[model samples]
Target: MYFIGELKGSSPDLKISLYKWNSKFFVKFETPDLEQVYKISEMDVSEDEIREMVNEEFIEKIITRFKEMYQDLGELMGDY
Candidate 1:
């Protein structure tokens, strides 16, 4: 149930990590400097008591977004 959020701000130097446990999804956002961390409360979801509620599309989208964010950060750091 992990899902990545849309990118915000300029420079594309932000990083986001997402993971699913049981039926809940958690997300954490960090800056390129790794000195700042923010939790996105808007995209939280719970899978309580739902065993088969997981969807493939949802997981795919999350991984895609994470990759894009990572690439954007790499570009900003001249590692692309």
Candidate 2:
């Protein structure tokens, strides 16, 4: 995987990174213990376009999903 760069302006608790691998671009968002990766075809979207695509609104949705995922994990762990 090739590291492109880190995205800015989202929640500080979340770390966002861009990468290229296997002819696909990987958009990775991470918290302390959890992460989410989104894949995009290089043929479909250029690198510059990716910056535009992963805007505030997109980050907001990811943040929301992360919250839901964390909640689900907590429930499954059962008082741990």
Top candidate, metric lDDT: 2
- Kindly report which residue stretches of model 2 are placed more than 4 angstroms away from their true locations once superposed: none
Candidate 2 TM-score, true structure as reference? 0.92
Q: Which ten residues in a row have the lowest lDDT in candidate 1?
A: 45-54
Candidates in order, TM-scores: namely: 0.36, 0.92
Tens digit per residue, CA lDDT, model 2, 1-80? 99999977446799999999999999999999899999999999999999899989998899899999999999999967
Candidate 1: tens digits of C-alpha lDDT, residues 1-80: 55544332213554445545445455444454442323333335333321223234544554566678767788988953
What is the number of backbone collisions in each predicted candidate, taken in the order shown? 1, 0
Per TM-score, the best of the predicted structures is: 2
Model 2, residue 80: C-alpha shift (Å):
6.5
Clashing pairs in 1: 23-47
